[model samples]
Target: MTVTWAGANARRLARQHLHPDAAATASPFAAPGDAVAAMLGAHAQVLSAAELSVGLRGDGLTRTDVRTALWTDRTLVKTFGPRGTVHLLPAADLPLWTGALSAVPTGPNPFPGNARMTPDQVEEVVAAVGDALTGAELTIDELSDEVVARTGPWAGDLVMPGFQAMWPRWRQVLHLAGHRGALAYAPNRGRKATYTNPGCTPLPGTGALPALIGRYLYAYGPATPAHFARWLAAPKRWAAEQFAAQAASGAIEEVAFGEAGPAWVVAGDTDVPDAPLRGVRLLPYFDAFAIASAPRERLFPGAAWERALGGGQAGNFPVLLVDGVVAGVWHQRRSGRRIAVTVEPLKPLSGARLRDLEEQVERVAAIMEGTAELTVGPVTVGPHA
Candidate 1:
């Protein structure tokens, strides 16, 4: 069988790459792992608002299996650190994948225009926040207050200028702490900050970071270092570090990605290629398989990126990937009973493909809390360049 380049695209590869079990490559999440491994690998967490919203309206159904997956194998996690947003990533892949994300360096010289806190100040804030969050969960405000009290009123002012600048580091600290020790979001805080320690047992921590990159490679790989960097908001060097780590572990191999630059092949044994989009999938707005790869052009080529994600910021569109490559954009018309979907195509979707896409939409509507007729509107075709 000859591998063809014409059909080679991220979305196409992704549908071919995803696991049916949804269990990640990490061990605890894999079958037959100890409770400690499960806790250490992928401690399940409720999806953040964006995470829930992204997947809710599309390809996935939030069901009992979703919950069980959360427990037995690490299935859900707070996928965050890029553009300062949260996503729900698979649990087993959480640690190392997140590590790549959190590895952003905290430095003063870097990122001028209101530079970040001084090294001493950064160390102090991290230590103070870690201490405050160690025993139990605390809201950011609550956590900040504790840190301020420990230091003084001036402490908040001292950190005020650095707040947003340092948030990634701060978020990383909390997440890593939650992973290793026990500092999680407080229940008092809303779901965003509502974190708790899963107190059964913990794994002998494998360290949070390089692990994240490893997961991204295995799950969303054949991707470039830049792709990882872009996806995680990480420095190129950090991306390189992650790739290096995975390479050391024999977790990755090199592969061709056409014009998308270098891509690493996931080295772990995987089930043979099984393409599901052959079935038409109404993906949740940000189903990671679509959004996780970062650059829109590299992932969904053609003039689609701007037309889809480029109104305000780049790549902010809910895509419609028909038979792989982003064939168009889609949205939900939430009425009362049924959810209406309007698909705007970049190229005319043929009758058969259109039927396939509709079948995917029907599944999406069924995944909702209640049943309703799913009507895929007329395929509005055009080269919306």
Candidate 2:
């Protein structure tokens, strides 16, 4: 059956718990960890953004609640997972993420020329990281020292030039350690972040890829293999093979998504609700809903794309979602006891939407634990530019 974009949007919004009325219902999530588990995980490259991502989906959850889940309760783990980015995932789900990520063939080393380490050397570094981080949390510098000590001085050699500085070749293996379930971020010590082994064992079997793909579709379908591949940062051929296998097994079924063409949803998740998406939301940077949706042009239509996404990049700034579509971009800055929130709409909003925007601003203020001042105007994009 062909699902129109409108139907898809409504389903997506409801499934994500972003529809205003849906969000108002008794929250499906009982805690911050529940929200993370439901969404697969929240992008946590920026801790505040990740916290807000959970807060938006959870009822009456605060930033402290998310921190407690990550540090105090240890119910959630922060690690490099999909797309090799840091994410806050349910601790119990680490096995699935680790096994799935490890199944992907490692891509080329980012270091240039002779600086690149052989595959063996890369494995050596990964092993060293596991050893260094085991049983104790260590800052990056401290961990690097241990890596060098374990793998010789060459492990400390700088490579991979960046806009500001060069990164050590050994640092590349950090994500590998995470993918192997040998590394995760520990609670911050003073102001410095540390890493430690999470002590999670992979589930006994070889169904990791299929399990991970199933979870993805449950949260972010109906989508194509290409979308899954892009989200996982895995090769398209590998994704297609896995997708085809699942389709053959009746684990997933194909459906047409209007102009988006053929897509797959979990075999039993084809029912799209006819809910109207209302109200405005101030979704923070790397918000899962905005980042995971496919057929980018449809999710982010017209000037909404350029205005909110800048030069086609996702997650650079917070977004303003009006009726389940990317209607504008927004930024929030906190100082002392106040937060200044500025919004730039691609088009004029209705009076009711403007009120809904104010309510969202209030919600943002509450999340920050400060009073908010709303300013409606164009936003200056780029990270703190």
Candidate 3:
């Protein structure tokens, strides 16, 4: 059956708690891990933004609460997730994530031979990293020393070009180590980040992709293999093949997605919301909501397509969501105990929507442990870190 974009996005918003009723009535995610899982994963390239990404979706969660779940409770593991980006994923889902991510087809090494490690050398470094991180967290430099000692000088050869210097060849496999269940991020030491092994066993990769596909469809369904491919940075052909196989097994079913054409949803997840989701939200940079939603034309419609996006890429700037779709861009600057939130709306908003925007600003400020001053004007700042 064909589903309208409004119907599809409504359900997607409800699943991710991006709607007003869902965000207000849904039981607050029992823990930060639960929130991370619901969003698939929270992008953590900018840790503060990641915290807000998770915090806002759940009821009354502050940045400190999110940090506690990460550092103290250990319920969330900071690791490489979809698209090989830093993300906060649920610790309980590590086995599934590791199994699934490790099976993803990666392109050939882009680095020069001097900077790339052979398959066997990559394995050796992954094993060494696992050994070094077991039961102890080590900063990057410390881990470098440990890896070199355990592997060899070849492992530490500074051949890969970095910001201003050469990087060790072994660093290329850092994310691979995470996918192999051998590494995860630990609490930072001052300004230096650390890594540790979560000590969890990874399930076999054999049947993980189909299961991951189901999870993806549940959260962002009425989607296509192309959408899945874009979300994971996996090859589109591979994604299509997987979808075909899954469909053959009756694991997923096709549906007409209005003008977007046919899409897939988990076999039993064909129900759509009765009405479009309504709400105002302030989404942080790289928020999973903005990153994973597909048929980008719809999620970022009209002016948002050009303004909120960066050369067609999503998540470069913070987003202002009205009715589960990107309506504007936002920027936050903190000064002492106050936060200045500036929103640049692409379209004119109603007086009631403006009030809703103000309330959202207050909510964002509360989550950040500060007061917010909202300004609905041109946001001068550009893409954030």
- Candidate with top TM-score is 3
Q: Over the stretch 233-288, how does candidate 3's per-residue lDDT look in tens digits?
A: 99999999999999999999999998879999999787887865777888999998
**Which candidate number maximizes lDDT?**
3
Candidates 1 and 2, the one with greater lDDT: 2
Query: Estimated TM-score per prediction?
Result: 0.65, 0.95, 0.97
Candidate 2 vs candidate 3: which has greater TM-score?
3
lDDT of 2 by residue, 1-385 (tens): 7767777777766666777777555354668878887777899988988998888877777788899899999999999978899999999888988888889865655566757777799889988888888899999889989999999877788875656987777876778889888899998999999999998776633688889889888878889999898888888887898899999999999999887789999998887766666678888998888888887788788887776675776777788888888888888888986989999888899999999999999887776667999999978756533
Q: Could you list the CA RMSD of all candidates, in the order they appear?
A: 7.1, 1.8, 1.3
Ranked candidates, highest lDDT first: 3, 2, 1
Enumerate residue pairs that collide in model 2: none
Please give the lDDT score at residue 191 for candidate 1: 42
lDDT of 1 by residue, 325-365 (tens): 56677766556656666776777778887777766566555
